[model samples]
Target chain A: MISLTDFLIVSAVLFCIGLYMIVSKHNAIQILIGIELMLNAAILNLVAFGKYDRFNNGGQMFALFAIVLAAATTAVALAIILNVYKQYKTIDPGKIDKLKD
Target chain B: MNLAQMLFYVMSFIALASAVFVAATKNLVRSIFMFFITLFALAGLYVLALADFVAVTQIVIYVGGILVLILFAFMLSGRETLNAMALQQKQFISIGKLPAFLLAALFLIVLLNMIIKVDANNLEWVKKSIESKNDIPVNAAMTEDIGVGLMTRYLLPFEAISILLMLALVGAAHLSRKGRGA
Candidate 1:
């Protein structure tokens, strides 16, 4: 029997890794990758706990919605990144300080 | 050390290792490939957790749709940005990223502490579910149940998400198209 704790630990580590990627990476696409990782970690948690929700399948349903939302967010973010690159000629988030007032 | 437990460990290792690579690697294209592996491994973990439908959805939507979109964006972006080799070489552990490393490590330690403190196996609802045999069986096919639920109980969110996706698609297309000045 694979305990729930095992799954939780894996996702926690994954989430932390994603957080590190988001904070440390200067590239916009790399940050998007990190966002995806964090979302996957949350989805993993939902599915793991959903195993116990036999009656409703709530966790799985929410995971589906979450995945869709992630896709949508990624699309929007990529589009914005492209626009930013166009205006600034670089994709490094750290260097794009035009909005810094 | 049952078969499921062993398989779970294998999948978890694959997912985490690739995720670490994705985070640490300086080569953007290589990290994208590693991210593919990470997503596939996570899909396997989802199956092991008895979310068959979700696992398939993860593979289909994530691998087929989102990753391809990301690749398209990568290709469309300027070569100067894509060619990240000359910019900086990022090691797994480096002095420049010390603050990020420390923050992530601290967050992991706190999360692990909280997870360990929660006795998930002996929780009241979990024990009750076990006693009543109300948990999902190991071999249950979740696709049909999920489909039914989507049409019935989750109909609102289902419809709402479709609308949201459509809006996002339109917004992305508009944003990515050339500006009037161009």
Candidate 2:
């Protein structure tokens, strides 16, 4: 039986990596990938907690909803990124700073 | 280590390594492939945790649907000028890179500490049988429970999510039209 600590540790690492990507990457698409990673980490945690909660399976339920939302979010974000690319001719978030001072 | 623990470690390593590649790799196409591996490995871990239905959903939605969509967008964006510009030429020398690295490190540390420090024995959600025996209820009825829950108590959110999905797809189509290019 794998311990819950193992799951938690993996998720924490995933979350941190996602944070790093979001912060350091200049590409808007890459940042969206980071967001997906972070969402996966959260879903992993939910399933881990669902192990003991046999009565309701609330964790699994939330994970389902989260998965659907993540899919929809990726679709919309990629469309937005495509639009951004059209406007700037570049996907680099740093170079497309219209509101920056 | 037993088979289960060994599997867990292997999957975890694949996920983290692929994620690092996704974040750090210069080639965007390579990053997307690596991201596919990361998501695939994560789904394997979900299976290990016995969230079987969620595991299948992960594979179907994330791997099959989203990754494919993202790849199609990449193919569409593959023009000469855009292709030349798409390389992640910006290294870790960006102004905020150091702060972001520090913040990620801090977040990992805090979460790991919390996970390690928590008394699993005293937690309310940690049922007595689970703590005493650590016996994961590896049963077939798990999917049945999920189905019933979705149709019964979770019917509202289920319908809402379907509606949200349709709207998002329509909005995405509208946003990515060819004439809107400026």
Candidate 3:
């Protein structure tokens, strides 16, 4: 039977996979996908913990806020990435090195 | 296992698989589509976990609002052929492979160890808490409670978020206009 521990384990694995993607990929949009994965991992943990929080549903509420914030952040980040593409003509973040010191 | 347990496992598997796909896919459009699928599956899991309101909000805000914005950004960002043709290559740069692998492995080990250390004895306490809280059970029908809570205790934050959203909308429009040289 699946338990909280199983959920936590899966979330942890997902987080690691996301981190790996963020570290390895140079594409801006691909990096955004990785960030989304990491956010989803945290949301899963919040909901799993909410299962035990029978009083106030605090964890579930937090998950809702998290989902909204993730979407908002992604929208803004995409806008920035689009602008970056306009200036650089490419989405490879490694090659968009105009600001690097 | 019962039907609920079976469904939980199915939904969880779908969520995890989609999450992995979101990370692993190379195409930007495909990755965003996978992200939508992942969010949808997570909403289903939220419903299963007895958070119906949260599930509905997830659908409306994420699927309806944000995904549209992302697609718009993708379309409006100019010279699509250039981005489409540029191929990304994997290069091991300054960040060494050994350190990255070691850090991720260490994070996994620590998280698993913590989960394993959770006392089984606490299971009975949790069950008892669930049982005794039946009088004030926060079930699917707690929509009224949520409304009341939002209006009363969370009024400031709710208003603040609305302001933030308005600012974001204005800022996005301004930035996009600047991009168009208007």
Candidate 4:
């Protein structure tokens, strides 16, 4: 009998790990990976809650949209990272301090 | 526990572990591999959650499309030394060690408390709704219902998302082609 608490706890752990990764990693691509992880955690929670949504399947549908959006975001982000790499030789985000406010 | 519960636990563990590895690994290609594993596990979890449509979307869009794009970007980008383990100064101790852990713990506690409260109130409503429902032949009915819903209630949003996607494509092309002279 896996409880909802179990699912939520797992999601929370994943989100925290992702946040830590995004904060600590110096590479732009690594930060992108962390963002993906965070999105996955949210999707997992949506699907888990969808189990209780038998009527409209709202959670399931939301998760579908989320998956698509994530893919789209990742594609755009990666492309931007490539451009960043072109402007700066290194992918280390710390080194690309040319656009500082 | 039943087969479904066991499968859920196994898939959840795999997804969480792979996600952690995706964040932790320094090698870009290795991180991509971990990302695939994480996506696959999430797809499995979606199936387990009875979101067949979402599961397929996850597999096709995330695993099939985005991951391939990520790998392509990695290969096309001229940065070869990115896979090297580049550690920041006081990597474990500076900025992330205590604050992240504390924030995570506090968030977990607050979220759990809110969930417990909400579930207590909503559980009976959900259970009652499920109990009253006679099982429809879902396989055929679900697709039709979803199609109708998309066309009727969600039509505006659906069309809007398509437009957004198109805009994104154009924007990406424009951004990338800036200094390349078409």
Measured by lDDT, the strongest candidate is 1
- Models 1 onward score TM values of 0.94, 0.91, 0.82, 0.84
Candidate rank order under lDDT: 1, 2, 4, 3
Query: Where does candidate 2 stray beyond 4 Å?
Result: A99-101, B81-84, B87-96, B129-136, B180-182
Candidate 2 global lDDT = 0.85
After superposition, candidate 4 runs with Cα above 4 Å error: B79-98, B116-124, B134-141, B178-182
Let me know the TM-score candidate 4 reaches against the reference structure: 0.84
Better of 3 and 4 by DockQ: 4
Decreasing TM-score order of the candidates: 1, 2, 4, 3
lDDT of 4 by residue, A4-49 (tens): 6667767877887788777677777778877877898899888777
Ten contiguous residues minimizing lDDT sum, candidate 4 chain B: B134-143
Q: Compute the TM-score of each model's chain A versus the native chain A and list the values.
A: 0.95, 0.93, 0.92, 0.92
lDDT of 4 at A88: 64
Model 4: how far is A95 from its true place, Å?
3.8
**What part of the reference interface contacts, as a 0 to 1 fraction, does candidate 4 reproduce?**
0.43
Please provide, for model 3 over B35-120, each residue's C-alpha lDDT reduced to its tens digit, 9 standing for 90 to 100: 88887887887777667777898889878887777767766655563345344432324344466566777887887887789743
Tell me which residue pairs clash in candidate 1: none
Q: Model 2: iRMSD?
A: 2.2
List, for all models, the DockQ compared with the true complex: 0.73, 0.67, 0.47, 0.48
Angstrom error of the Cα, residue B83, model 4: value is 6.5
